[model samples]
Target: MGIKIGCCGFPVSRKKYYGEFNVVELQNTFYDLPSIDWAENLRSEAPGDFEFTIKAWQVITHPASSPTWKKMRRKPRGDTSNYGFLKPSNENLEALRETVRVAEALKSKIIVLQTPPSLPYSRESVEWVREFFSKASDIAQGFILGWEPRGEWSKARELYDIIEEFGIVHIVDPFRATPHLGKGGVVYFRLHGIGGSEVNYRYKYTDDDLKRLHEIVSKYSVDREVYVLFNNVYMFDDAARFKRLINS
Candidate 1:
């Protein structure tokens, strides 16, 4: 009925997070996927009204060279050259399927595919994204697909076009830029914080910042679902403050 706010991951205990917020954008799914049984257990442990939105596996969006891969519990294997940047390679497609399997286990309605920040946009790169999503669509049925294209393509028309063409939600850091909603009219904000790249994780939202965020997300809430998931270091406290500010 209104803007759904939460942290990107559990900033506190799951029980506390679930009690305080109605939705969460799962970040662990990006680093390492939980086994289906684990995902099901996690889901069963949450409150009945809790909602989950998954961040697609890093193998599909980031290359083996990506530092993010170092956090994986199971090391990557095989010819990983084709992995990441949505290359539509066998490795990436397989990763997509695995992500979908976990999403299904969690009963997640949204599956977000985020491109690596180092990805450079080009004609070939654009085609690769298209090809990946094209293959991904088959496995993405019954879920709201989201794309967070970073670097040069973050706010480009090509990203918008892909979203429109494939009916995907645009995942944006609303503090940096406005999201260009496509046919579905869904708004998903990943609030990294208000600052330069270095300041993102450390920065905290002020009262004015929360007021502006509330104003921006409110515009689209009347028509479609709008999500605001905080990803900063102070996400737990910040999100709680935001909820109180808006509800008060």
Candidate 2:
């Protein structure tokens, strides 16, 4: 069993980050696609044993109205609704294709699809995602696709069924919800800090929290490769602490 601990994005210089952890989930790719040259350069610089997981471009899951779209180099034209929301539109399909190219350039084995909290649960929405993934399956071969559905969709059984059907890994914040979908192989945990009704990005994990997290990972690590990525403000420190706690 193996547990790879890291942060959602780099919190320190590349050299320091590589020295501290064995994995990283690239957050830049979620906001906008980077050039293949940039991805190649990063891959070339990283240690051979280091692993990179990338967030799929927002254009595949978020609509134009999403604030994250403001950072994108290109904006959607007419009928912006068709551009994202996993509608199986041509525009979204092309965006996913571009994401695959970037992932390949970085030699990333995991591609995370994080939907906005606004995308609520519905039978129609479930069907749309099913169709979207089905259409893109060819491009997704040899990659571990992880879907982090937020809002009401995060609570739906239909969403879980779709994940199982598509062979998608369920990405979750263990502090929020334990993943009930997907078969065993790899478990991806994104910690966003437990707080009121939603994630508290400002909250830092305590030693007690780290211990509990270690217990959770140990349970899963019996037969799966677990990736515990901290997404809070203190992600770098928290991940380092958890790594020490788990290894001890």
| Best of the candidates, lDDT | 2
The lowest-lDDT stretch of 10 consecutive residues in candidate 2 is: 74-83
| Location of the lowest summed lDDT over 10 successive residues in candidate 1 | 191-200
* TM-score to true structure, per model: 0.96, 0.96
Q: Residues 1-248, candidate 2, lDDT per residue (tens digit)?
A: 78999999999998999999999999999886898999999999999999999999888898878888889886644467787778888888888888899999988889999888888567788788889889877778889889888888888778778788888899998888888647649999998898966588999999999988888888888889999999989999999988888767
**lDDT for residue 161 in candidate 2, whole number 0-100:** 80
Instruction: Find the number of clashing residue pairs for candidate 1.
Output: 0
What are the clashing pairs of model 1? Answer: none
TM-score of 1: 0.96
The residue ranges of model 1 lying beyond 4 angstroms of the native Cα positions read: none
